[model samples]
Target: MVFTKKKIWFSSVALFILVYSINFMGYRDYFPLFLLPVLGILMIRSKLSKWFLITQIVLLAFLVCYCLMALYYGYFSFFAILGRLIYPSMFMLIGYYVAGFDTPKNLKSFSILILLITGSTLYGMFSLIKTINLYGSYENVMSALGGRLIEDLWGNSYISATVLNSSVSLGLSLLGLLFIKSNDLAPNKRILKIAILSIFLASIYTSATLGNRTGIITVIVSFFTIFLLKLNSNIKGIIRLIVFIISLYILKLLFFNLNTFGVRSYWESSFIFSRFENSKVYDDPRYEAWTTIIRNFNENLLGGRQINLSVNFAHNLWLDVFYDAGIFPLIFLVIFTIISLISLFKLLKLELPNIYKGLVIGLYTAFFLTFAVEPILQGFVVYFTFFCFLIGIIQRKLTSATY
Candidate 1:
């Protein structure tokens, strides 16, 4: 396919996969810096649609949230709210690119593009094992992997792996649907199959934080949706699901630790908040910050904003909203999200291609979990791209007149 200016216009929304795909090379490095121009490109050419209009309204509502924050707390706190959007907005641009790939043939082409990225992830895991570098406890993990800490990819034990997990899980789950549809894939197709399995296993073996759980759960939800909706129609799906369950159980025994720190912590931190809010641990500061947010919201629920919220996102996405903006924008965000979800659920009823349905279901589940965990992660890139794909798929359904 030639690089046409029209198609390339949506490259910005492709920002989520591209940024994280590069991050597999270096987390918190120069790649994020390069995303700026790509995002700027999106700003220029992104055409307006219902999805686009909704997102803009949501953001505008959030700005009102910021106003409430400023008036109540007398602190202009919009940047914190804006910061959450940086990555998500970039991802929304990718949806525009997907919009162009609306046909079955184009879907196949786009699937290849996704696989190419997943392929790099397989290589990254091997590179990690070959040249691992460990610091502190990571050194111990490397010893466990039998490569000193040198097997540590990018000097971070799980960062690269976790990001790849998100990309590969979404990519492979989508591809699996396609593969199941055909008995005669190309000669090189086996490599893609290997890549999918390898990345899936790697994601399980790699130690993960709370973020991993969201992706894991998302994949499960997506596949199950596919299974219920399509697997019953094909015997291969039953076999694939049995293998998947067995594999995840086996990996859980080898890797998944239920007692890990942040990953283990429940959303309700009341007891911890009571005890540690009085102690010097980071938990102590969280209450103060949370308190700061609530107080501000009460003062100006309409026009508020938060600035320079301390390190590592506020954990609770809704709380982050109350802390940064205010309540009303939060309401708008909720409504916007509800509408998109309803749109997809409606699509699932149509007798569309299982491959397309699986991809959409899996991504929707994953991003929903992500939203519960992280505020900014639930932004434009993920939602926009996802819905745009749905829109394209929906267009096909329209011609079918499948209500």
Candidate 2:
């Protein structure tokens, strides 16, 4: 059956929403298991570029070599090695299929769908918050809300906020960038757009209230990145952005005092004040992990150490990959990242719609920033999958434009 491009795009969007919703509902394992076969079928039907095919071949080759090394050394179980390969493979296949049907409108639609899913998850978080009393401490509130506060090896506590919070923050930040860059909306739709923007901003505020530092950081960094990227070309635009940022800070201070919004206290307690106080005591786990990995380099230079060598994640993507799969796979990952960034940079230079470009930049930067704090590539497979799909869509657009 020949499906129109619109039909295919809509189908892909629906599937994405379904998978994300299931993920938010705490069925991440089962949903991906079910979704992979469907994505494989879509990939089989999609026409892919030669470069994409070559890239996949290289990635697969690296995975094969890594798996063989792991088996040879008994470093990881068969099931463990297979699990590591599955997500990236799923990302490549689903990304190819979605890219085949990508269009500016489809991208916008998919982004809005993500926002809606984020809204649902935010509502769930709020419901949990409501069950706790006003006097509850942050730890108590977060404990009631689900997700644990883990202590690193050095005895520093870290909030491992739920995936839903991170996803909501990511969606809200991207949606904000899209809204700010979109100048072509109908004049009559101004109020509607403002309402939607307000909702997204409120969700961001909710993320802060829930002690999800990553979400708050993503929103701040994304907006700053978009402002600089979109406005740096003109003197007036630069001046306007500066004034806008100043005014925003002033307003934030005023609201912070009034506590008119629930966001201020939490933001102050969780991020601003706590971060400063903890700075003297908190030795970042990522730094420690990287140090340990380097110290053990000779032991795991070609083949990784046995899985029993460490019970904790490396907490940095590059370090994690290097520790788990050895130097060859780490080299392959670095090469893949460099190539993807070059392609994305070229796409950014194109005459695409501002909102589309902003979305790509925002998502890419946010995802990359996450690698410094978590082994996102290994654990947050769903987010990584979406990032890969966006990469593929951007590549497809660039290819079409060149032709």
Candidate 3:
């Protein structure tokens, strides 16, 4: 089969969707292995922009420096370093194609992909319902099913049915809502638009049910940021905003009234005063992890210590960078993040469509929030790749003389 540009593009998008959507299951841990061939294909066929290439080179150089230092320290493991590099490297490749190829079409495809993900998550929620019905409690259901479950400070169980996948779904739903709001649909297309909106609402509810504070906060922040930024100026925007608020209120009431499987009460409790009062204790582990990493820092602050440490990551991106690769790499990562934010802000200032701006904001907010709770650049492959893709898109737009 002839692999034309269009074919390659579609194939890449399909692979992305497959990897991203199936993450609701437990298979995402091996996604990097499956993504290897796709990355190779993308590297060979995709066109790269100058800035994107430069960014990759800098990251590659840093990785090489870090690896050599680890080797000298007798902690070098080829596969270990390779595993760490896979997602970010793949992200660069994703960004390359996303920037140089058909962007608008790819964006549309991504919108559809997210809708599919929302549907899959809803299915998972329903499955959880079934499990609860059978087992009489979330804990009993998880015990029977046997998977990771996180309990919040209140002893309320939160299922990792979708794990980190909820973060991506939340970002997508925000972007999808913005897209739907900004676009004018034909009478025939209104149903489809409504369906997408309903799915977005459901995705938010599911994120809340999953009990990932970061994911829930990301969705809320992204929605309001996009809403205030794009919709505050117009009367129609205000009406839409009111409608959105009412819809959310109604959804919350429905969930509260139904109170199925204790999910509603658990979610509601997450927002109550006691949750905030006990937040410091709830965040104690993360704080202790950071303290441990800092206390264990070796003398070589430039090249970092060996990767053989028992506690590998710090859970926070900045602290993790410092712990894993030392102060130099930490500085580099911070600079990169600052530059990405500046670029995104510049892109937002451009006279682009409201939908495009909203998409950028959604991606930016999600990535930023993830850094606080997840070592996204280190382990969360989907989100890391998505962040890099958004960066690539922003870079492409900023550098293009036409825009």
Candidate 4:
């Protein structure tokens, strides 16, 4: 059947909502299994390049072998296994299909969809905060919210959950809003734009609410990187930097001095603050997990091995790939990332809208930061798959001559 733009639009939005809801509801390993037929339809309609297809096939082949091993070892059920396979495949197909939508109409539609998704995520964050206020601690909050609680080896409590794909979605959505400027809007509509922007900006505090330092850091770093790229002269850059520092200082003073709503104490009692107070920057369970995985490298060098739930995967994307699918798949992962990054760099040099450029930088930082620390491939595939979708956008921009 021939696919019209309207059909593609509906399908894309439907797929997006389905995937996001599955993740948001914490049904990653169960609900997504049923989406294979939908994903199969997407695969049939998606037009991927030879390289993405080849690399995806090789990567999936290794993952398939790994999944079989998992099954043989009774690590997960068949349905869960199917869900695992479908998540990455579905995102890749959707990425390919959506990335080619570079027209103004498509961008506007995507902006609306992203706004709705981000708004929903904000609501979830608010709910989480309210729950925390009522409970006073994240312990046993998993039932109320949809996240699991964990106490580390150091006797510290953490609620390692987010409204969307672990705050990466929030950060990227904000960046997308920043980049996709609606400059032509009438003056009367500017207030609405500013209000939306304000809501999103305030949502950064939601990172603290979720105790997600990575999210906060990625957003800050991405903004700084974008700011640096926009600088045309050293003097102007320095002036801007000084102004930014002054503004931050003023905000800091206002923040610390105010205790009107008792929000400061709540923030301090939040998970992110607790982490900063209790742990050093390098002091994390992931470091030990990485060392242990490497120490037992030979055990997972072939068909890989089962992962422990306590520490999750290796918490490093490449190491997890090596530990789960063995050395061959790890090599392919490196190849895939390198190719995407190279293309991203090439896209950066092209004359494009500042919004897309900011997205490229912000997404790059967010993806890398998460990949370095999170079990993205196994537990948070939505984040990485979304990164793949951004890569598809980058590829489209690079191939387009009219931009």
Which should have the higher lDDT, number 1 or number 2? 2
Model 3 Cα shift for residue 371 (angstroms): 1.0
For model 2, the superposed segments whose C-alpha errors exceed 4 Å read: 1-9, 24-26, 32-45, 65-83, 103-138, 141-165, 175-206, 252-272, 280-282, 303-311
**Model with the higher TM-score, candidate 1 or 2:** 2
lDDT of each: 0.48, 0.60, 0.58, 0.60
What is candidate 2's lDDT per residue for 117-140, written digit by digit as tens? 454445435443443334265566
Q: Estimate each model's TM-score.
A: 0.56, 0.75, 0.68, 0.74
Q: Which digits, one per residue and each the tens of the lDDT, describe model 4 over residues 107-192?
A: 43234335434544554455556556666766656565556443221222343563233542444335433533544332333654
Residue 389 in candidate 4 has what lDDT?
55
Model 3, 271-356: lDDT tens per residue?
Answer: 33343456764465666676666775665375454333445556777776666567766666676777777787787777665665
Error of 3 at 329 (Å): 1.7
Distance (Å) between predicted and true CA of 203, model 2? Answer: 5.1
* Candidate 3 lDDT for residue 151: 31
Candidate 2 lDDT for residue 84: 53
Global Cα lDDT for candidate 1: 0.48
Name the candidate, 3 or 4, with the larger TM-score value: 4
lDDT of 3: 0.58
Candidate 1 at 230: error in angstroms?
A: 1.3
Task: List RMSD in Å for every model shown.
Answer: 9.3, 5.9, 6.7, 6.0
Q: Give one digit per residue, the lDDT tens place, for model 1 in 1-403.
A: 8878745644543553454553455553234446687657755785456655565456455545544554456543345334333433343444443544455333443453354345444444544444433333434554565532333344444433333334433443443343444223333556645655565565434313212344445555656765666666678868877887898787665554553344334423433333333555345444455566665556645433443445434544566665545567668667656666766777677655555565566556655554454443322223323333444434334334332
